[model samples]
Target: MWVQLRRSARTHVASVKGVAWTLFLFTYTDYKTIFFPVTAFACVAAPVQSYTRLLHGVIWIWLNLLQCNSSNQYKSAEEDALNRPWRPLPSGRISRSQASKLRWSLVPICIGFSACYGWDVVLANAFLTLTTIMYDELGFAGHWLGKNFCNIFGYVTFEIGATKIIGTSTALDYTAMISILYSALVIFTTIQTQDFPDVIGDSALGRVTIPIKYPEASRKFTFVAMIAWSVFFSSTWALGTLSSLIFCVLGAYVGSRIYLLRTVQDDKRSYVIYNVWLLIAHLLPAQTRWNVLPF
Candidate 1:
């Protein structure tokens, strides 16, 4: 009986790992790691206060991940079967009913948590959740523009909630506005590359992503956008708004890498590069606060 119990524990652990991979928890965790710190640093403006808020931010991030990824998986199960057969839903590691139940369960928990922060946080969370529902149920993912818009909306909502939690401010200030704009630009221009890995699945589902809609142009566009982003960050560094030379160097390196891979059609590489670029971008704001390079 002890041996059987140990085997059962191992099986449960393996199943959890499979679900985590299916939900892209690593990517979401990376996003929160970069975003929440920056938001807390920017709003709280003190290390002690920022650290305090960080705990709440972590919970918010996990709730967001659960709400977004699970719903996405439940909605995109059919397409995922073609594009990502290894995912929990597609691989039969989890049932659709289970995923649906998980998603619905997370919704109230997220809203309640946000309510603890403030009405602003609650409102932002509600909006973000609504947008996620629209993106999945209304087939907004069918168009590249719609998909990008959804992403931007989600990120903005996240920032709003974070800002409200940290600063108790619901109004968009200069920093918040700039962050939103930068994130929107990133979502609009570079997020398309993420679809590269799932082209087959997306195509099978008749989804119109940039890689599918403009196969050749997509690479060129992404390359150019990376260059443009690099220049923007470098210029900000020059202007003293961006605090670190490392981010400038990192941006240049990522841009150059993407440029070199402009001709490569590997979705995995594109996905990896895109994630790297995003992490760098998210880290820039935090660097402005914590790791300013003296000129």
Candidate 2:
């Protein structure tokens, strides 16, 4: 009986680990794009929340991410196969039909998760769901302008919902709203930086991304935005001279790479650096909340 019990425990442990590994593989790529940013904004905006509340917020974001990624990956399997072959559907971790089922099933799960927070979060999730539909099904992602519009609003919902969860309030205060809008504006301008590295795959598919639409202009504009936004955010956030200098340096590094390198691999590296800057930008709100740094 003792041996049987130990064997059962080991089997259960192995099963748990298997599940965890599967989830990790499905969602790891989005850690930079979604999970980390949402968590950062939440923690920065509401630093005093309980661990349990934060964990619940994490679960909420995870549910929405599962829905978002599964849906987008289901539809973009061909693109992923070309540009990001290791993704679940492209790599055969799941079939297209299976992914479709998982995608649709997550919708209600996300809604239920949001209901715990209130109708406010539910509305936020609903807007994101609508944005996903527009981007994935309505052909919004096929055009550069439509893509940015969807992305701007989609990420804004994420910021708002996450802030509400960790802040333990259905209604965001005025400052939180302003900060989230600032983040949204940041995303609207630079989110297309993600498209630069996908030029080849996008070209193969005849997709029109900002990078593909105006190759020369896109890189130059990104360079300008990086420098301009860095100065704007640092000044508006009232970051100290040293802190602002560090922010500008990161911006300069990313901007220069995007403008100068003009290669797939270089753009990939620059995109990662851009996400780092964006993540730090998300934390700037904490400077408003608490004296995170001194001049």
Runs in model 2 deviating more than 4 A are 1-19
**Alpha carbon lDDT of each predicted model:** 0.68, 0.86
Model 2, poorest ten-residue lDDT window? 18-27
| lDDT digits (tens) for residues 64-92 of candidate 2 | 88888888888888899898888777877
- What lDDT does model 1 reach? 0.68
Best by lDDT: 2
Highest TM-score model number: 2
Name every residue pair that clashes in candidate 2.
none
Q: Write the per-residue lDDT of candidate 1 for residues 131-216, one digit (tens) a residue.
A: 88889988887898889889778877776676656553556566556766676677777777677667777888888988889987
Off by over 4 Å in 1: 1-48, 167-172, 237-265, 286-291
Q: lDDT of candidate 2 vs native?
A: 0.86
> What's the CA error at residue 189 for candidate 2, in Å?
0.4
